[model samples]
Target: MTIKSLGNPYDGDVDLRHGLACNCSDCADDAGHRMKAVSARDQRTRMSTDDMLDRAVESAIVRSMFGHNELSRRSFAKMLGGTTLAAALASVLPIDKVKAAILDEIGTPEKTDLSVGFVPITCATPIIMAEPLGFYQRYGLNVEVVKTAGWAVARDKSLNGEYDASHMLTPMPLAITLGAGSTATPFLMPAVENINGQAIVLHNDHRDKHEDVSTWRGLTFGVPFEYSMHNFLLRYYVAEAGLDPDRDIQIRVVPPPEMVANLRAGNIDGFLSPDPFNQRAVWEEIGFIHILTKDIWEGHPCCAFACSQAFAETYPNTYGNLLKAIIDATQYASDSANRSEIAEAIAPTNYLNQPVPVIEQVLTGRFADGLGNVRDEPNRIDFDPFPWHSMGVWILTQMKRWGYIEGDIDYAAVAEQVYLAADCGKVMADLGLEVPAETYKSHVIMGKTFDPAEPEAYVESFAIRRT
Candidate 1:
């Protein structure tokens, strides 16, 4: 049998000549066949090693949990599903105690060498930097930080199992779980990578007109995705200025990478997009930063590290370790001292694929506003891994406000289930980070207070809302 060797321009030509007929005297007979066989055997050997390690970990858990009845416990676990077994154990054991035990005794990860998807934006600071910074490896995991094309692709890949986990918009998991734009599935956001990192950028021509947003009617704007903080904040900003976002102006869904080019080509007048695109526009002299999203709603959540609930349940230890890695990375990114180093780490082609200076400006928050003034706002972009349930409640209100989701929504229930605050809080506490006493916090978006208890009323409070 003749085997065709593969080659690419990036990797150079493949050597098809092997042994028997080989020109090199050091080669053995049919070396290529032996090499192929060895490669196949090595692949199986690696998989078996992981399986054996996982079984050993499970055996340890069974021994720890059941003492003398380890065999019976394993039998019961095999009969009932893992989820059911955990629930059954919780009935006998205090639920909180069981959770604490599980947290402490998390075993070998179910899966490693994971692929996590992200759009190359500053909001994904922790997830992107975890690769080069060795945070993932520190947690006994191997993670591939894949740079995706856009938010839609990222969401699709996540839903379809192409990515084990992903960097998603804060509202994406909620929307996905609720089946707003896609199939209904149980999605979970265990951590928020960064907050207040988005901005509304306007073409350089509109730099003079800052105060009166109402005067700029019929202008075109871009958002990365519909279920994104950028879209919600942009809508709130325009609606507050008495412009109906759906009717008054055109809001196009443009990927972050193309936002600056769209502005330069006159395809869009402006965009409410995640950095470093906003800073990229300024760096290229195409657009000016109009307002940071932080100014719209302080400490607002943006991009999240999300995975399916199925992924979490199937790989509990892997998920927990992944969360811990992200939490640690987030803590590191929160410090001002690490901002410059993080910017350099994530700016390469394999990650953000942007200029280092643009990434630095976005991270350090002292940037050229594109109006000839250097703004010094240190909190412009921040890393906080907590998945606050109140943030979920607000996003639901906005989704209902804009008519994306109809009918009565049990906001708090959905928020709690999808946000995974209890687990997130546990991880944060375990890491010695500050954990909020309550899962909910009231926020003021564009001068209007949003009470998590009264989401319906909050939607009604918006005069320019779709519903």
Candidate 2:
């Protein structure tokens, strides 16, 4: 619903394209007059329904469009199931006006300490390698990398002010916004940690003999962790296999590293892992790659660098510099030669805790399906200077889908706070990175064809039942 329907949530007119937001009603009155020129009657009568839908929804439809709200993104987005931008705008177009609402950015602070923490995960590799490679220091930071276990612990240290920043999940930062996880303190929106370095490894126990067990049917598999990106991807994959994740297959929890061991012994089927370990699963020949997590989501998101909302506001320069260093590291990692160095470094005791070759095989984005299947894709991981707040919005929808939150909320508002676009912009301008027209990452979810233009519709089109 629009703000006016909710008692004029704000007064002025909030023009997204104009980059000026007036929460007051007077602006809404003004906007009503302006939008009158662009109507359905003016549209070409010959336009097909698909074109209309595309023009109406556009890519923003699939993006996580949100604003400030009392309701958590998870709850708010779920309530708007099948809610179109047109319908959402209808609720706010005071006196029958069509308007756009682009979320506003939160304030930022000055400089901060350069020291940051790291955990032994594939996603954290860039953070670690960048330190020793002089990426952070070159960007004016005396970079420090701390080692830890588990995402929660890493996030806590980053939030508690123990470390300036850390490598984390794309959803982890969003969960922080919703006050999910084991913390009363909330995390601000992330600058995206990593993209597409994850894989799902199944245990041999389910299939026993790794025979061309390509499809999911009677065979059962383990999910490892719930609410984590891997778990969601796993569910999407199983459902696409024509098997009910909750019924058709046995789903259980196992650590990313433990997946390979369990698969070898016959305790559970394949599980999910990020980098070196996923590469380990293949090298060890423990189990066949049933479905790569990156393949399921394709150009999907993985990790992010995040901090508490308070931290970003108090130390803007520090935050900006930190982001600058990471962006530099991202450019370094994107370079093919530096990637090999990253794989070799993380494959050791500090990161993935596996062999360099294993890490290299997976991080390089080329994989063999043990049974003569191979895939090599470029642009899987990105570090562009785009002001895309879509990641923050999409994650909120995922959280709401599984009943993690319950209430009506303002998605655009909440998402705006997390993106830290203005802060990112200050640094992007200084660093010379150009923001994208509309940031969009390719997505391939199991049986679901991700339609960025009408994501809600595509997701609703599923023949399978919704949970």
Q: Which candidate comes out best when scored by TM-score?
A: 1
Encode model 1's per-residue lDDT on 4-108: one tens digit a residue: 111110111112112112223223443544354333443344435243333223323333464313235446555775567757755775745543454355556
Off by over 4 Å in 1: 1-106
lDDT tens readout by residue for model 2, 1-467: 01001111121222221101222233346566324323344233433333322232232222214422213332443455334433674565432221122111211224323446665666676677665443443333344466665666676787778877777766766666677765656676446656776766655344444444335555545543454677666666555656566666666666555666767776765666665566676687766665566556655767667777677677765566567667656655666665665665445443455666666666676666565577675543443433356555555555555445456545556667666666666565656666554544434555454444443444445455342
Q: How high is each candidate's TM-score?
A: 0.79, 0.66
The lDDT for every candidate, in the order shown, is 0.78, 0.53
Clash pairs, candidate 1, are none
lDDT of 2 at 36: 33
